[model samples]
Target: MKEKLIQRYSASERINHWIVAVCFVLLAVSGLAFFYPAFFWLTGIFGTPQLARILHPFIGVVMFLGFFIQFFRYWHHNILNREDVKWMKSVKEVLKGNEVGDIGRYNGGQKGMFWVMTLCLLALIGSGIIAWRPYFAIHFPIPVIRIALLVHSASAVALIASIIVHVYAALWVKGTIRAMVEGVVTHAWAKKHHPKWYREMTSKK
Candidate 1:
């Protein structure tokens, strides 16, 4: 039987999600422009190299703040349980597409992504503050500023990689994007992809 689930995401939640997504895309492109000379052409999209340099840090800060809101909203649900640890141990079964029945609300991969992104954001924010030119760096020691530069670059790389995996997972799971876009999943989708969550939601009423 097909059943409609009540809205899981409010209008505010959807707005926040898209805000973060757009900022992320901008940050990724601008960051890449500065990261590689070969990708220098990308800066033209934002105007010039000088403008890209000026805007990158500001864009990064906005994206990180947006991500912080999402992290808080979903952190409770994404917590790792014993089942998640077992799912990680049996990840091979997941790769073979045979462990759908055993997966929980998030599964191990999603939990791992959540944690990794959290750590990366912390690193980026900290390093960015220390390395902020024309502001914070003027008071800090040069050595500290240099270290912060390295940390910022490393964290950005990790975050970009993590987001790539995040995007891939969303696309890999059918109906996943629709859940985010429309803010609701069908009962069949909930039951098939997150049986425990489905049962809990249904049992509540």
Candidate 2:
């Protein structure tokens, strides 16, 4: 039997998502190496430690730009609504292999993570500029630079944690990863996980 499929993301959207994902992994590995002595070996990801230091900020800029484009593309769908509130309140049930409310393109957890990523990216770029030596850092005072470095580190940790959760959630939910990777999902998958989105898409067809 031929399984029905629905387009969840276009080729361009999937490409952009992957670009950001790759940049994020590179940044996380290098950033951790730079931030902690124990994980300094991770610098090998970008060649030598010196190379990692040089490439970290540049990769960060790319990730920021990539996610910035994604933000504008999907932010509207991620906006919280009454259904999202219901989903959030029943998160425990959601964890027990059940979905809640009339989910659209994203559930409450996905919506929350979207905003968290946005805020973390904003903090990272802003503080990173202030702490980027021999460039914008030179204009800032020593104490201010120290604070920026602190903020940058904290935000990086938060972003890393959030991404970990994001990855886990994607893996935990059946067919979730396929949506991003293949840019399509089975009709059953869509209808089960995002009923409202399924309806919207089907209505258009």
Candidate 3:
């Protein structure tokens, strides 16, 4: 028997999600403005190239901190389990649009994505601190600063790609956007997508 679930995300979670999302958009636009001449026009969106350069790191800091909040909240649920390994083995089926029976709370893909984002956040933050100019960079060695720049740019590119995939997955799955926006998922939607999670949430301890 299917039954509705209570709130899966609180108001704080939604707020944090949006904060990270907005920061991501800002950083993406500004970062791209400097990445290529074609995207140089993007700086106009923020004001000027000088201003975009000034704002990118600050925006990245805010986005990463927001991600940290979400990371702590969901970390426990994202731990890998035997079920996740099994789900990984059947990933091809999942891509083919077949629902692997007994899909767990997050499945392997979501778990992998969570860890990927977490690692990327750490890399971005660490390298960002090293490369930040007119401040910390003055104290750091030139070689260290150069390496930090490389790592920061590489991590940013990888993070952006991961987020694109994440967004695509959210949109690909029907009812997913509503879950993030409204903090609720219908019982049927939950069961069909994450049977193990649905059962666990609804079951008596």
Top candidate by lDDT = 2
lDDT of 2 by residue, 70-143 (tens): 99999999989999999999999999988899999999999999999999999999999999977899999999
Task: Mark the regions of model 3 whose C-alpha exceeds 4 Å error after superposition.
Answer: 1-6
Deviating ranges (above 4 Å) for candidate 1: 1-6, 100-104
Candidate 2: regions farther than 4 A off: none
Give the per-residue Cα lDDT of candidate 3 at 99: 70
Per-prediction backbone clash count = 0, 0, 0
Give the C-alpha miss distance for residue 54 in model 2, angstroms: 0.6
lDDT, residue 204, model 1:
83
Q: Judged by lDDT against the true structure, how good is candidate 1? A: 0.82
Q: Candidate 1, after superposition: displacement of residue 185 in Å?
A: 1.2
Candidate 3 local Cα displacement, residue 144, angstroms: 1.3
Give all TM-scores, in the order shown.
Answer: 0.91, 0.98, 0.93
